[model samples]
Target: MVGAEESGRLVTVGRRFEVVRNRPLLTLAVGHMTVDMYAGLLPMMYPLLAGKFALDLKTVGMVALAYGAGSSLSQPLFGWLADRHGTRYIGLALSWTAITFALLGFVPNFAVLVALAALSGIGSGAYHPMGALNASAVISEARRNSAMSIYTTGGTLGIATGPLIGVLTLGAFGLHGTIFMLIPGLLIAVVLLFEMRAIALRPRRTGGSPRLVPPPVPIGPISVVVGVMMLRAWSVFGLQAFIPIWYASMGYEPSFYGLLATTLVLANVIGAIGAGHLADRFGRRILIVGSTILSVPALLLFAQFPGSIAFVTAAAIGLLAASTTPLLLVTAQQLMVGRAGMASGLVLGLGFVMGAIGVPILGAVGDAHGIQNAMRLLALIAAASASVAAFLPSEELVRQFANRNSNALPAASLPTASS
Candidate 1:
């Protein structure tokens, strides 16, 4: 028979063990979903915004630029802060995003709308690295790829659902419907805060001090990964930003185009989850290369077709193109051992910035040429990304390189033989 003290200890141990379980992952996944839903809403709302403001495609693209610049450019700083300190403010960041994004509909002018979008993006920027860091930390190494896929799926699913929500709300109430977007974000923020506090209260098993400065990352391999990510982002963002306008010009209604956009993003969810498991089994580089290569043809088909056939091609584009996201993320993290946050920031931030920049360029192309021609350009970009992905180091090489760098000290920090 156990004494009262023993029973209490058992309960504490059980609670501590629970912190490393699926609950925290679920909480973070939900938070990711809530944050990324806003990203999805922007593209869906572009038609409405343009109609109201009498804006051209280029002007509408500026909204994406502002939001993307804020979110993508600020990631490294937030990541550095998370690495140095703990991610204590993650929930606060979510709350801030929810409030700012909710105000988007209430803005008096286009400039004000752009500004609010940027502000909301800043909050999203803060949440990403923090959420990613925790997502990786809560799971074991062997399961990281799968775990990241699940986490990323949450965001992808949110993006998928966002268009539907936008069509429903904006269709009925117009701009004022954006106010309802705040509800899920706020609720998820509370859940994340509680989960974070619980995890913090759990006892630490290791007393070792964390390294203040991480080892140098492999520049050659990381650069290749980033290049691939950038080109892919260029294509994906172009599609997301332009698909609605492209279809609208072809005389399709909001309901039809919106569902098409949602279908495209939904395929990303399926691809991400499947790719994660496949990467764990086959290899990351192969998956990256094959997916990007296949995406070239899929993108071409998407541009060549419209209407019912376009949906099938869109799903193909989503699966073959956006599926590499989690794999690239995991590859970046593996290239830098102790600097997961920084690695995540660099990969996600740079990729997103490229996407942001591409939106305006694609819009310009759509203006000068045509939207279909601009989409064909995306196919060319995907081919380039496939070529870049071919140069990425294998999993075995990456592990060896990361381990070596992590264990070695800088020349200045190394101990003298005489000592």
Candidate 2:
């Protein structure tokens, strides 16, 4: 019943809001890339450190454990802090991360090395929740998936490229060569500081004080989303833990492992960007369900086949499996509308913890029952996750969140993208 002129005006307004809201997110994505690059450093350096310290498997694992404890376990706490306080210090946190991880090559003893890794982990943990919150806040509800996907892709790209960087740096200058890597982190941190300051200059509505009270909303849908994420993580980490070992057992060179990993990860980056763009038009739930359903078969194909076919299936699995993550994050933020920091922390941070836990469990199963059987189990988990995706919140609930009271809300109270 609206007039044609009024409709055109409304359309123009929508477009303008979309452009303004999404402009800040690209800067945040770069910061995400810089922070995640540090995560890849540990994996690349592990071999050198193990050889240098004469570390047994147990000792090596302990070093990983130290990093994991700080990075994985503390994310939720940081998320709460960001939501309750403010994300103004995210740039500073990145600088902290740069300093800690860059000092890796200078540690004098194994204990010192472990301590530094833990400190670096803490810095990494502090960066994600705030970064995610800022990304969500700066974008409109409809564009959330696309924006987040772009952000996620940056991290994936950084992680994929990090091994190459590490190899070149260490090969040229030995262990102490890590000092050079600090420059990028510091540079990125400075950029983020300026970007965040510019964002602050814009006028914005303020949010409520942080409280201990639980969010007053239906918990069922959020729980289902979290469960789906955890299941996905289990499969992902299982593959990450064993893929290189599987290739080695087949007599492939170590560099082949890196090649395969880079291919899968790059494929993931592509999928994330593509899926995000598609989800904005096609709807998030369908994209998530369809991708997850397809990934089970892709994973099975990868495990059952070998050689080039295996690489193809691995790419497919990575594409489908990895793309759903940003979608899941957007969904969680939608469900807990005002708690973007907490939602981001829960989905991204907790998912990492779950993946870390899954590695050893999957490793044990592989040892006991054979890696093939273990891969079969991962396919089953993927299938289960796909099944669970069917029960997300109804369309009506999603619509209410998106359309009702949209403009009157504070930035944090705005409904998230993805139903």
TM for every model, in the order presented, reads 0.89, 0.82
Best by TM-score: 1
lDDT of 1 by residue, 209-279 (tens): 54445578789999998898888988998899998899998999988999999999999988887887777
lDDT tens digits, residue span 92-135, model 2: 87898889888898888899999898888888788888777777
Task: Quote the positional error of residue 134 for candidate 2 in Å.
Answer: 1.3
Question: Which parts of model 1 have CA positions greater than 4 angstroms off?
Answer: 1-21, 200-211, 408-419
Cα deviation at 142, candidate 2, in Å, is 2.2
Give the alpha-carbon lDDT of every model.
0.82, 0.73
Report clash pairs, candidate 1. none
TM-score of 2: 0.82
Looking at candidate 2, what is the lDDT of residue 219? 71
Off by over 4 Å in 2: 1-23, 49-65, 106-113, 171-175, 200-215, 245-251, 366-376, 401-419
